[model samples]
Target: MSEKLTLHKYQSDITGLMIEHKAFGVFAEPGTGKTPTSLYVVNHFRQKTLVIAPIRIAYSVWPPETKKWSDFNNIKTGLLHGLDKEQRFLDDSIGIYIINPEGLVWLESMVAKHKRFPFTNLIVDESAKFKSPSSKRFKALKRVIGLFKRRYILAGNPMPNSYMDLWAQIFLLDRGERLGRTISAYRNRFFTRGGFRGYEYFLRPGAEEEIKDLIKDICIFIKATDHLDLPKLVINDIRFDLPKGLRKKYRVMEKQLFWDLDEGKILASSAAVANSKCQQIAQGFLFESLSDKQKYDKVTKKVYDLHNIKIELLEELVDELNGSPLLVGYWFRPDYDKLKKAFPKAVYFADSSKSEAVQIEKDWNAGKIPLLIGNIASISHGLNLQKAGNHVCFYTMVWNYDMYDQFIKRVLRQGNDNDRVFVHRIIANKTMEEAMIMSMQDKSAMSSGFLNAINLYREKIKEYDE
Candidate 1:
């Protein structure tokens, strides 16, 4: 008898889902086997799969990950990147074709004119990138969606701020199937007039039920934490207390801007103190007034206070593991600067060619740079850094949950000695950090829209069941 294929319950659920929904959505949390689950869906379809992911993810994630499972070495794969037409064609002719979303800017016009490609399926990995209707990438994706017979969008964080994100991804799968005849119809049905610049704007008004009903048939949503027999994923929140002096200053600024509602008065009240606070928070030393035309002058000296605190926190954990490499996720320029300066040899930078990024990845894999500092834009979605660091530290939070979730998943993946995936967020007390985290939890519910997408899935499933 053939060897029995083993799968986790959620993985099996996804495999079953593939038979039904031509376009499906997997909204599981980070570190819950989303990568493998997504690949299983592609493998089952047995088509010329075209995966669009971040460049780094396109280059690294699939190769090593696919190798971990069956002896499917004969399976062909190609990476479509750069501005090379001849190379892309050569690669696309073979197995799975992977391309970056940014590369769509160049290929969009070509695809429009040629209108011919061999792709059987177009998988929008990290579909949140196309959530914005105004983006050039969104237009490019729509133009190319017609070329592929089957379309699938994969994302953990689909809804960023509003239901507006639901429009673009759903359009790619089957336009007019969900929402309504147009994007405007869906917006007007669920939203009511709110506020604008001395004018009225529209907002969602208790429309969760309506939003859920709209996409009921086309999406598959699952949470890893809700499933059984899965390894334990412990999530913790770490809060930091601001110093007494800084707290007093923060309160005064907070009252002026929030309570008193005096923008000019607040600025005038603490001109010196505000500048100093901003500079210090920036991980730079003192703020100095310059004769430049720009309103905000640059920091003059090197401030080691923020670095000292970050290093102290990381070192405490790293020492416990006998100095095992720790992958530090940094986004802001100041965070990157502080991390790079504190550990000069460990920072990863993206170049035009992205060769530096590749080398840093290798060094990290080989455990050369134990303390790796990376930005989400530079290293978030596509790369696998799990071999080097099983532990992750977030200096601050980012607005995009796609980048945030993808970066952490890079470390907490399969084949590591980590007892538990350690994710630490060094959030400053009572700042945007708290609000950003809360927003992330809410925005990730874009996956829940799949419950609304069930009607579409039921149609497809009924056909398959017969």
Candidate 2:
């Protein structure tokens, strides 16, 4: 007997809409099953599909999703990345070509010189990455977007930072029919320049509504709350104060924008460099030299570690969680190294080898590997870590609001078996970490206007259903 396929009412609705529209964007929030919904449409149509996604997703997500569900098991899939890319291209056995967004230009180059374009449809995962019209990926993809008989854009938070993110994304779908053909035209219609000597453009009054309405015809917005019967999320803000000496050093770095440490062997002499130095200090450690710092140019001095305050907090969290698996989102290179040393058996998501990474993912999901640690930027957009565990710890916060918003969904999203997930933010009190969190929150608020529109549509649907 064939396997049964069951999807929620909203999932069925969006899948139906995709088949009807042929080309559209799905601003479905995380845990809403955008992957399965898109796959269903592709299965029904049986067209050769091109999926453009971030490197992590393109490598680990799409192929796994296809394999997990028997519903789409027969559809052939190939990954266009790394050394085996040419083989994947020539396989002729696969119907789906998944490529990283960064490689779109190279794909264009391939088609222009020696290859033929084969995909009849395009699915741009993490469409927000192409929010900028001037980006090389978007420009390259635009030249051939019309070649696809169908196209779909997927993003959990579609407009992560600003409404400006909407223009290029919408353009790829409707060919600038909904938004203006040119970015400048779109900007002039809804924004006015006002910030910093008229260099920045802020949205004019009611511009959000106008922009929302323009794209509503071809876009579907699905909220996780309305669709998924999900577990509760528990968030803990664990804040700590720096030691007296460390506090003084941080103050010097922040105020004077310079610091002399280790007998002039290490120095932070500029505002940007000082910012990195101070943030590192807040985390209970600092590289011995500015040259070894990632945020700025490296100095020639040897790197040194100052403390392990946050590491101590992580140790406490580990003890508190007992023996359960935990997913830790470490933000810095040093943090990853330190975390691996502290949690010896922990599995890290890395770029060691493609097959090994796949095996690591399988091991994690199968409950064999506990304490999985990954950089937030590396694992943000895609990859299903929900099965591993429900506790997600942010050892360090990130600057981009979207990454913070997306990273949590790994465990909080649909298919998670746990009853409730815990999200921990180990914050440094009175430091840049606090400032970074606040800045992200403020920027995230910019999406409330779009969410309001989504709420209104849901209400209209609820009334009709009643």
* Candidate whose lDDT is highest: 2
C-alpha displacement of 182 in model 1, angstroms? 2.6
Top candidate on TM-score is 2
Per-residue lDDT tens digits for candidate 1, residues 1-466, read: 2222367877887767766777766655555666677777777777888788877667666654566567334456777775665366555446677778887876665555666466888888878778776788887777667778777777766765456677777787777577665667767776665322222223465677776776767776665456633234455555665566655554454334333212333322223233334324423222334454374465343334432465555556556767677777776565666566666665555322455666777777788876766776566665566676666777656655566776777676554556677777766555434544664565442323222232233333343221
* Candidate 1 lowest-lDDT run of ten: 445-454
lDDT values, one for every candidate? 0.61, 0.77
Looking at model 2, the pairs that clash are: 288-304, 291-298, 291-299
lDDT of 1 at 152: 75
Error of 2 at 324 (Å): 0.7
lDDT of 2 by residue, 161-232 (tens): 678889999998999998799999999999997533455567899999998898888998887878787779
Off by over 4 Å in 2: 1-3, 254-275, 287-304, 439-466
Report backbone clashes per prediction: 13, 3
- What is the overall TM-score of model 1 with all chains considered together? 0.75
Candidate 2 lDDT score at position 434: 63
